[model samples]
Target: MTKRAKNTPRWTAGMACGLAIGIGLGIVLDNIVLGIALALCLGVALAYALPSKDTQA
Candidate 1:
């Protein structure tokens, strides 16, 4: 029997939320460069914030 990895719903949700917020802010602020930068930063930050699921036995 093989073990399956756990689903990362929180990470997905965080990324979606971050992207939406970044785009929305960029549009509101009327700056494409700022929006892209914000999105990238947010994406990286979110990715880093996600918990690692790798197990060592």
Candidate 2:
């Protein structure tokens, strides 16, 4: 029997959430540049905060 590896998501929920919130806030505040900046910062932060699994076992 062959075992299949689990697939990891390219974008985590936290990253997506951060991006959505950033864009929404930027739009409401009427600044597209701010939205992009916020999205980049928040997405990086959120993505970095996530726990990564070690592939080497």
Candidate 3:
């Protein structure tokens, strides 16, 4: 049996959420540039705000 990684999942979730939101916003707003910019900014901000694996342990 193998133990699953922890922080990796959380990070993945964050990225997925960011991507979904960004894509949705971009589609609804009809602006590729704005969507990409917002997605990147939000993604980075969220990633920074979340606790890292080292910190959790």
Q: Model 2 reaches what TM-score against the true structure? A: 0.61
Candidate 1 lDDT (Cα, 0 to 1): 0.70
Candidate 3, residue 34: lDDT = 83
RMSD of each: 6.6, 7.3, 7.6
Top candidate (lDDT): 2
Global lDDT of each candidate:
0.70, 0.75, 0.72
Candidate 2 structure quality by residue, lDDT tens digits, 1-57: 899755443357657977898999899999989998998788877765654564325
> In candidate 3, residue 32 scores what lDDT?
82
Q: Which residue pairs in model 1 clash with each other?
A: none
**Candidate 2 lDDT score relative to the true structure:** 0.75
What are the per-residue Cα lDDT tens digits for candidate 1 across 1-57? Answer: 898866443466567667877888899999977877787678667755666455323
TM-scores for candidates 1 onward, in order: 0.56, 0.61, 0.62
State the weakest 10-residue window (summed lDDT) of model 1.
Answer: 48-57
Candidate 1 Cα outliers beyond 4 Å, as residue runs: 1-15, 52-57
Name the TM-score of candidate 1.
0.56
Answer with 1 or 3, whichever has the higher lDDT.
3
lDDT of 3 by residue, 2-53 (tens): 9865543345656666777887899899998888888877776676667776
